[model samples]
Target: MKRYRFEDLPDIIGELLLKMNSIEKLLLENKVNNVVADDDLLTISEAAKLLKLSVATIYTKVCRNEIPANKQGKRLYFYRGELLNWIKSGRIKTITEIQLETETKFNSKNIYK
Candidate 1:
């Protein structure tokens, strides 16, 4: 079995969050409606738009507990602020490094020796 670490991915995810925050700020300064409401609650579609991710992916994250979300009766809602903070936490940072380590381990195996 191969183990993967989440710390291996670059800080690209953090950069992406900063970019998104910048866009949101610019939109607010330009009097364009921010994607998230003042209360910070967003529907799945709205969050997907803000994250530039597929709704299915968002739902998957929600299900996997990768993102913070709560159900209000039958409605599932996510908090924009929480989502942004979560992204800033760099959960994907380990991916690339873990993959590299696994590859190196497999290559170092003495299958021919």
Candidate 2:
């Protein structure tokens, strides 16, 4: 290790403090990410509330295999992320989006022809 002069001690300490602060921030961020990634499973009623549907409707969807779910014996569970994705999959395209898609398809076909 290189010898440090008295004048360099303060600078060295400040650098060390900055590194520690950055490491702490990184650790905290990782913990938050882990918590979000390991979200709790939702029961049928809770899933219904999240989806703004009735419990009966949730059960019907599960029976029809229209929604993603898990079953443990008689208990039903849903992943929040999967439920959110299921909602997203039913998204209706806006008029502008439909027009853009039509234009792209027409142009591509014309190019091939």
Candidate 3:
């Protein structure tokens, strides 16, 4: 990060605040009901809507450690970006993809038959 001059600090902060307000306005206008802020830690209900799952299901996954979350006392919190990435990581491979992987494994010749 570049060091900022103390003299110019207020101007820089004001500009950042304006940009933040602009971004907030745009987000509100778009009506993005599921995920709102850039770094919002979501509640169980919010997480369920974002993931298209039920609140009970989210609780179940949290208990089973199948999903990523932070447990604070009795509360659960999830990061929106991380949850989206986790959902992406569970993608199913097609038949061709499985065949290609199998072929690659056999071609490597390092495995014991």
lDDT of 3 by residue, 23-102 (tens): 99988877765456535899999999999999999999988999999989999999987898898999999999999999
**Candidate 3 Cα misplacement greater than 4 A, ranges:** 1-38, 110-113
- Clashes counted in candidate 2 amount to 0
In angstroms, give how far residue 9 of model 3 lies from its true place: 42
Which residue pairs collide in model 2, if any?
A: none
Tens-digit per-residue lDDT, 56-88, candidate 1 = 998899889888888888777888877787878
* Regions of candidate 1 where Cα sits further than 4 Å from its true position: 1-38, 91-113
lDDT of each: 0.81, 0.92, 0.90
Point out where model 2 deviates above 4 Å. Answer: 1-31, 34-38
Hey, what RMSD does candidate 2 come out at? Answer: 6.7
**lDDT (Cα) of model 2:** 0.92
Provide TM-scores for the models: 0.46, 0.67, 0.61
Please report the candidate that would top TM-score against the real structure. Answer: 2
Q: How far in Å is the alpha carbon of 62 misplaced in model 2?
A: 0.8
